[model samples]
Target chain A: MIHQISVFLENRSGQLAEITHLLAENGIDIRAISIAETSDYGLARMIVNDAPKASAVLLEAGVILSMTPVCAVEVPDAPGGLAAFLQLLAEAEVDVEYMYSLFTHRAGRAYMVVRVSDETALTAHDIKLVGMDELGLK
Target chain B: MANYYQPEIETASYEQIRAWQNERLVKQVQHVWDNVPYYRQKMEEKGVTPADIQGVDDLHKLPFLCKDDLREAYPYGLMGKPLADCVRIQSTSGTTGRRVVAFYTQHDIDLWEDCCARAIVAAGGTKEDVVHVSYGYGLFTGGPGLNGGSHKVGCLTLPMSSGNTDRQLQFMTDLGSTILCCTPSYAAYLAETIHERGLKDQIKLKAGIFGAEAWSEDMRHDIEDSLGIKAYDIYGLTETSGPGVAFECEEQTGMHINEDHFIAEIIDPDTGEVLPEGSKGELVFTAITKEAFPLLRYRTRDICVLTRKKCSCGRTHIKMSKPMGRSDDMLIIRGVNVFPSQIETVLLQQGYTANYQIIVDRVNNSDTFEVMVEMNPDMFSDSLAKIADAEKELVGALKSMLGIAAKVKLVAPKSITRSEGKAVRVIDKRKI
Candidate 1:
């Protein structure tokens, strides 16, 4: 299980840039990041290299944030990679909530952080799971 | 016995109040007619004279005096006394337009102080109490009015005008100040500071006379809880001898108008017809006993109601509910009269901060209303859907409260500019 930090943000200009800049300034690297925004507010979810360190830095800077459990899986870097993995999850009855790409990859494979309720279902299918330690510059 | 500054006047009978108003109203009318040609012309146009305005019932016959009249009568057009007799002058904050210059003779100052003293005593102030006045001094009437009242009540008046919270607390603790007099917002700020500095136990405030602006009952409770005092609301405009024309008693229901000094009447702002008791309308005041700057039937523009109901405090003076909104500042959004206070009441009821801004503009020949509420850290959630749901709930609550739909935008914390003085809560950008 990987720790994903989600921050509450308004649909404002320079806000995403502000968080990214804060992470860069604090020497915390974001491994994977995605934003889901509505007409009024936005939610930025990030799988940083060091989730606890990033959470502390952001919280210390008065940023509204929370951490949740997610699993990062390596998929083959090909056109059929995501579809095959999603089909495997469907066959294994792994209820995938949402998935987004990571900024870094290892050995010709792309990393996808998937929000799922049953991590055992993924493990039951022999999926290769990656933790926060193996994501970025350790 | 209740602690009253003037027992005879505070507990005056309605008949006695009527008798005093009748005598003073007639004389004030004559004074204005003789000394103020600006008002004399108004009377001539209305075909009424001092003789016509024989008593309180005849108050309606006099032509109404509005803020525009005060502006037009700028410096001396409304003076009921000669220049030499006028010893002091207090100007309004003038957030509206032209500043209303209210002249005060020595007698007027004495009476105004007497009004403030009534408020202090009503708030449980005594000669033994050290009154800390935090209302701004100089042209603004809050400081002077409360300061004079504290002196009149023989309280150790600290003449501490607004601002400098650290020093205010320093003096408040060191001198053992027992009564606080400032705007309600300032009182709240002081309460916030006292708790933050961990000096609430050191504070000795028994009562706080908060006025010069509108505040909610919830806010009163908040300040009372933090400061350990009964919060009383004092209502008065600079146009009508400053912040002691009416005051809240121990009942905490409504402020008892000093009916002998100034007569309060509710009137329809549009038609200028006086409304009956309990009918919420624009508050019109007749400064029957004011000598230097007598405003006859001054339309206060403050929307409120009046009640002569027997108060538990035993004051026969008419009690006025807190002014709901100013007719001048009332926003007519999409043909519905929307007051920022209505929005504030809804916000406070919903357990949100009062730090909100109202934006009204015209869009495509129609009105657009929006309320920008600061998204405090507590209300923020990691889920956007939940935050949107909260915004939608606020919109529903505001629509039901204001009888019109208002776009509620939860902006970032401190995105909206905080106010130091009177908070600019409404921005009407309609080009009408």
Candidate 2:
């Protein structure tokens, strides 16, 4: 699943708000986002409801966007649930570049979006896969 | 080729050149000792008199003038002539602190322009060529020095200054600028921008004179290939009348010192002992003919080697290789010496472009050096593992070359910030 996408942005005030406003105006909801900034510019990675539509809207808005396929794994809402998933990835020699927690309307279940180095190994572990719409993000 | 002062100074026999330098050196020493108070006081402290310095061989008895001495004399303390007589003033951009100002009387300016003209002619420039000088004006020495020199050579000079790349290229193409003068980094940036805008063939630039910062040999090759122009290195300091202290001849082997105007010396940077020819050390110069600020043995702090071998172009003035590093800019990391140029050389050799940043920070009282290099756009699609491997390879290369451990981070294309002028290559974050 295309769970996470990274967008490059120039580090200027109102840039992030402008990007988010454009997405909301186009009816594409953002599930979560994280920003990494150096001295001059920023890079924003976000998980959105509709990856393809969000990308198109961003492109038309004159924003550069890149999409990467990340795993959306469902885990029990317990203390070590997230830690257990990370431990599995660590043991598999897979580097997790970034991860975000995802909440769902479904009871007693939690989903996490993770972009990792080894997608094949993660998929081969038989982790539950969820789509953009199934997460109620669209 | 206008009839500029082609005094055959370069190819003059060694004995004849020595005689000319000796006569001028004695007169310059007497004038400085009698007129400049700074030199008088220094000589008094050292118990040296003008009579003691008879020839160029006796130049070592005189005291050296380092940057601190220049700073102490601040705006114009070292000038031997009155301000009204000074035709111009050029200075180094004191990005670190106060600027080191150099004054030039009409005579000094003429000599400086003559040196610059020699550099232009050596690079194949002629009266028919339009020389575009993009070195920044105002406090910076690059602009006015080249502008005056181009005019002296009877070439149509463009005092375009720097920046506004669109206008720079427009004028360069439309006006048929044949010789480009600016910092090497800016030249590289211009070349990149020109290719991106699909105007490579429109530019008529045949030669480039690049300086103001130390650049590697690989950078010269890159700029030459990208801009389709031959790049030459010019060395000078604001303390010694701007960008004409030495220039490359047609041989392009090294920059030939204007031995007629300035006396060159290579000294051990730490011990202050004069080194034999071909030894790498700090380059020191004494302005034997400068009437305004006649600095005696001003230490340039630039690390380079001098070669006395006769060139194919027949310039007998000793040639100094392009500076590899500045003594002041060397950083001590984890008990090992590190120079930004070393990393730059490694990066360029590995086929990486010159866009890199060195981040030095202290971790547990141990200095850690991290080099962040930008990947080429074509390599952006490589697998993360491959990218990581490349980064590791760079780290290993740096370690082996510098004999020090360093962390290498490979970033996406255009990730590192680019400067319109001199690129900020080093960021010593340990202070923060």
Instruction: Return the top candidate by TM-score.
Output: 1
**Cα lDDT for residue B275, candidate 2:** 91
Pairs that collide in candidate 2 are none
Count of backbone clashes, every candidate in sequence: 0, 0
Among all windows of ten consecutive residues in candidate 1 chain B, which has the lowest summed lDDT?
Answer: B330-339
Tell me the lDDT of model 1 at B360: 80
lDDT of 2 by residue, B119-222 (tens): 88888888998999998888777898899889988999989998899889999989999999988767888888889999988989999998776556777788
Give the alpha carbon lDDT tens digit for every residue of A1-138 in model 2: 754667655555887898899989999878777776555445677888887889888777656566767778888788897788778887888888767777567777898877777788887776676776677654
Expressed as tens digits, the lDDT of each residue in A53-111 for candidate 1 is: 88888888767787878888988998898899889888988787678998773567998
lDDT of 2 at B52: 99
TM-score of each prediction: 0.62, 0.61
Compare the candidates by DockQ and give the number of the best one.
1
